[model samples]
Target: MGCCSDFLQRAKPYVAMISLQFGYAGMNIISKVSLNHGMSHYVLVVYRHAFATLSIAPFALYFERNVWPRITFSIFVQIFVLGLLGPVIDQNFYYAGLKFTSPTFSCAMSNILPAMTFVMAVICRMEKVDLKKIRCQAKVVGTLVTVAGAMLMTLYKGPIMEMVWTKHVQPHRSSVPETTDSSDKDWLKGSIFLVIATLAWAALFVLQAVTLKQYSAQLSLTTLICFMGTLQAIAVTLVMEHKPSVWKIGWDMNLLAAAYAGIVTSSIAYYVQGLVMQSRGPVFASAFSPLMMIIVAIMDSFILAEKIYLGGVLGAVLIVVGLYSVLWGKYKENKDIKESKVMALPLAITCSEGNGHNMDLENEDRRERKPMA
Candidate 1:
């Protein structure tokens, strides 16, 4: 009974993370369907954040009312920028890209996020790199490999690989013309948009790390970011989409997409990921991202009858490999740091217990002693 309970405790984080990935996959597919049905990306962004803000606000108000810190000018500016990068820029561009391309492609391309974040961190001097260290070398190599995979996916759209279900399901053609030249151009454009969105997402993560120092109430911070993002997205939506009709959503996929993305992906995902990260660490949480890509690929083929290409398959493989390499390096680096700290404590205690002369003589004697055969 004890062993079974212990096993279940260990399995909880894995189960939660896997379920979270499935939720993300559902968001991508549903959002793609909504975009296909003439829902403007601009309007979608606004509504999504509005729902997110409403969902998160009550919890923030109730739980963080006592502990919430005073918002200063600098913190406000950071929060504003966070809102801009996340809701306004990231979601809009991501939705736009998904409109042009398939959900699987977008999800696969998003796996480059860690590589982009690493580069940005290096540029910001927030991360250190030592060529001599194998861990650093792995990270550098993995980033390069990830970039190569993205380039491959963008430049080469090899022959479409047919799936069993796709053979039976009629291809759901969109309003957009599928001429070879136009489709290729649209794919390139979508790839560029997805890349831009990923970069903004990475920047948001970096900025969020810095912002947390001043404002430590995470729920309140998330609520404020969502509220500010909602306002910003509304302004952008008004500017981009003049048609009031675009704002109208009923009991359909649009409403479902908005509600699911805002509530499940934005609010609940953040909370659940935080819980999992607390138990298994951030590496474990992020390690399952590629699983979402795979799930989306399968679901896209089955549901949307979307065509998959050989180049995309190959590229996704490379990205997954590179992602694991980077994660492994990070895990090793963290383990080494923890081990060093543990070793330092005992050494510090030993030095503190002995007089300086005695400690020095003991150290010399230990160094002078020969190993037994």
Candidate 2:
């Protein structure tokens, strides 16, 4: 029972992270369906978070009813900022990019998060630098490689690879048009949006790490983020979405997409992510993001009939390489720190014990040498 419990404790986070990716992959499929059916992304964001707020509110109120901390202006400001960074700015830009690109393309591009987060952490002085260490050098090289991969994906679109799913595919209206002018234009535009979104996501990872220190209730914190995200998205929706018709969600696929996005992606996902971050730290939680690329690629191949491009495949390979390189470097550095502490412990104990024994001897010698005692 003890061993089984230990195994479960270790396996829980990995399960949660993988499950999160599955939710994201489903969201991508449903979202593409809704977008193709003429639902505006802006309005979708508004509704997604609104339902997310509703779904999470009851749990937050119930679980944290008595244990809630005193809310301060600073904490409220932090949560508001988190809402803007994540669900508002990050998600809006992401959807805009996805509108102009395929799910696999967007997910592959987001593989830059690990490198992006490292650079941002250094800039913010949250992470220490040691250029002499090979670990630090690996991280720097990994960041450059990841960025290069992103650029390669944006600038190049080589021959399409034939896959088995191509035979069973049905054409979708939302797929990018096959033309030099339109494809190139939309690719660049969407890539820009995705890059900005990735940066916002990386910043959020760092900010959440800091904020969790101040506001320790993970569920309540995520609930506040969703609530504020709903309001912010609505504000954006009001400015950009002028058509009341676009906001009309009926008993069709739009409602299904919204329900999936709200209940599964936003509410459940946000809560699970909060729990994981509370346990594993930000990088550990965010490192699982690359898994979405594979999930999306496979799902889109079948569901969206998206063609696989040579450049995208190669870029994704490079990005995955760089992602894992940085993670390995971090792991090695942390391990070294632990091993160093372990090695020093015995030496420290030995030095103190020897000093104590010497003092005892010296005191006894002085007493023996005393003229009278």
Q: Considering every candidate listed, which one attains the maximal lDDT?
A: 2
**RMSD (Cα, Å) of model 2:** 3.3
| Candidate 1 worst ten-residue window by lDDT | 277-286
Relative to the true structure, how large is the alpha-carbon lDDT of every model?
0.80, 0.80
lDDT of 2 by residue, 57-166 (tens): 88888988888887799989899999999888988898888888877778767877866777777887866669899987776776667666765765687998788768
User: For residue 130, what is the lDDT in candidate 1?
Assistant: 95
Candidate 1 similarity to native, TM-score: 0.83
Residues 1-373, model 1: lDDT tens digits = 9999988976787688789889989999899889989999998888888888899889988998999899999999999998999898999999989899878778877777766677777777766789899988987887778767766765687999987777777787743346699898998899899999988877876777667768878888888888899899999888887887888999999999999999988777765665654444443455566667777877877776767778878877887787677767776886798799999999998878777778789889998896877
Check candidate 2 and list the clashing pairs. none
Which consecutive 10 residues in model 2 have the weakest lDDT in total? 168-177
Give the residue spans of candidate 2 off by over 4 A. Answer: 1-15, 165-174, 180-187, 278-280, 341-373
